[model samples]
Target: MTLASSSKPSANRKPTSYESLMAGVAAGAIEGAITYPTEFVKTRAQFSADAGGKRGVMSILTDTIKTRGISGLYSGSGAMIAGNGLKAGVRFLTYDSIKELLRDSNGKMTPGRTVLAGLAAGVVEATIAVTPSETIKTKLIQDASSLQPQYTNMVNGTIGICRTEGVMGIYRGLWPTIMKQGANSAVRFTSYAWIQGLMINFTQPPSGKLSSTMTFGAGAMAGLITVYTTMPLDNIKTRMQSTGASLKYRNSLDCLTKIIREEGVQRLWGGTTPRLARLMMSGGIVFAVYERLIGVMTSL
Candidate 1:
C-alpha cells in the first residue's frame, strides 16, 4: 500500500471520460436493476443493529414484505442507477488511460506502475464521477429505515435536502465514500496487474501479444480479490447510508472499529455472498467490454 503517488507528472491526452461514462451508464443501469433489491437487503443487514441478530438470513426479504412491500427493496434505486453507471464506466476508462501514459518506453507495462496508475485514476474517477451519486444513493438507501426521516427516495430526498440542507444536502457522507472507493479502486487496479500476468501465463495467448480473453481472465481474478478486501469498507459505507444513521460510528475508521467491537470482525463482511457474485460478474462484463473498446481504438 506504500506505493508512489499517482500525482507524478505524465503526458496529457484527451480523456474520453464521457464515452466510458456512457458505457458504464448502460452497464450501471443493467447492474442497478438486477442488483438493487439485493443491495437494499445488504444495506439493511449492515445497518440494522436494532433489528438484532439479522432476524436471520431471510430477515430482509421478510421485512421488506412486512414493511414497505415489494417496491420497498428498490427505494433508492434511482441514485444507484445514476451513480453506478457513471462510476463503473468512468473508473475503468480513466484507469486504462492512466496506465497507458505510464507505460515503459519499451511499450511494456509494469505491474507496479500499472497499479499506481490505476490508483491515481481511481482517486480522480471516484471524486469527479461517483461521489455525488454515491451521496444520493447512500441517503436514499438509508431512508428506508426512516431514521434520518429527511431522505426517503430520490424525489423526496432531493427536495428534502434542497429545503433544509441547501444544495450541499445532496453530498452527505462523502468523505467515507471517497475513502472506500479510492481503496476499492486501488486494490482492483493493482490486483489486475498481477492477475493479468498470471492469466497470460495460464491462458497463453496466440502469437501476437496477450489475447483479449487472457486480459479479461486477469480482470476476473483481480475482481475476486477486490470484493473480499473492500467488503468491510462497504459494510460501513452501507451503514453510514442506512436509514437510522445517527448510530454514531463517525467516519469509516470509527464505524469499522465499532463494528468489530459489537459484531466481531466477521460482521464486517456482512453480505459478501451476493456481493462477490455481483463483483465477479460485473468486473468480468466491464473488463471484457473495455477490452473490446480498446481493440476498436487500436484498430482505428
Candidate 2:
C-alpha cells in the first residue's frame, strides 16, 4: 500500500507525530488485510518463472484456492499485517518530520525536497522494518506452496528460519528491498502530490482539503505509476528473499541478470498484474483512511 499524502497542516492545528503514526498504523493494517490475497497470488506468480510454469494470475489464484483452500491466500498475512502497520507508521512519522524540516519560510517544500524526504523515509522504513518481515513472509508463503508446508505460522516461521539460516535469513534481501522501497516512495509521493495539486487547481476546496473521492483517485493513480516503475526491483527483492536465494544468486545484481538471461526480460515484471490490482486498491484505501483518521485526531 502507498503512504497517505502529506497534506498541508490544518489551519487550526497540525497533527503530532503520534497522531500520524497511529493513523498510518490503522490505515496500513486495514489495507494489508483487505489486499493480502492479491499479494499471495502475486508472490506465487513471481515464483512461476523458476518453476517453468506459464500460469496467469487467475490461473494461479484459482489453483491456490482449489488446492489449498481460502486460508492459503492468507498464508503469510500475519507477517504482512504487522510489517505494513509498523513500516507505514515509521514512514509517515519520518516523512512528515523530514518534510517539516525542508519546508521554507512560506511553509512549502519544493518537489525535489519532497522527493528527498520520501526517499529518506522509504530507506528508513525498509531498513528498520520491511526487510526482515518481508523475508519471513516470503518464506512462509513459499513454504505453504509446497506439498508439505514447513512453517505453520508467523512465530513458528521466524523461529524456523532463524534456527536454520540464522538471524540474517530474515534480512536476506536488504539491498533490493531498500532500492525498491526508496524508489517506490519517491515516485508515489511525487505523483500523489502532483495529482493532488492538479485536482486542487481544478476544484479549489475552500478548506484546502480534497474530497475523499478525489484523494482516493489520486492515490490509486500514484499506485499505478509506482507498480510499473518499480516492478523489476520488486521482483528482484522477492527472489532474493525467497528460500535458497543465496545459493541460487549471489546478490541483487546477479538475480536481475539471471532472471533476464533465463526467464526473459519480461519476467522481471512477473507479478505485475496481481501487484497492480492490490496496490491500486491499497493506495486508495490507505490514503482515504489515513486522511480521515488524521483529520479526526488533529481536531480532537
For residues 232-262, write the lDDT of model 2, one tens digit per residue: 9999999999998989999999999999999
**Model 1 per-residue lDDT tens digits across residues 1-300:** 011122222232323555555555566566667767766676666656424555444777787878778988788788777777777777766765676688688655666776676667667766776666666766666666664456556878768755766775555556666767877788877776556555555655443234556555666677789999889778776666543454575666787787888778888888776677667766665666554554444344
Best by the TM-score measure = 2
Quality of model 1 by C-alpha lDDT: 0.65
Off by over 4 Å in 1: 1-21, 50-53, 65-70, 145-153, 207-218, 243-247, 296-300
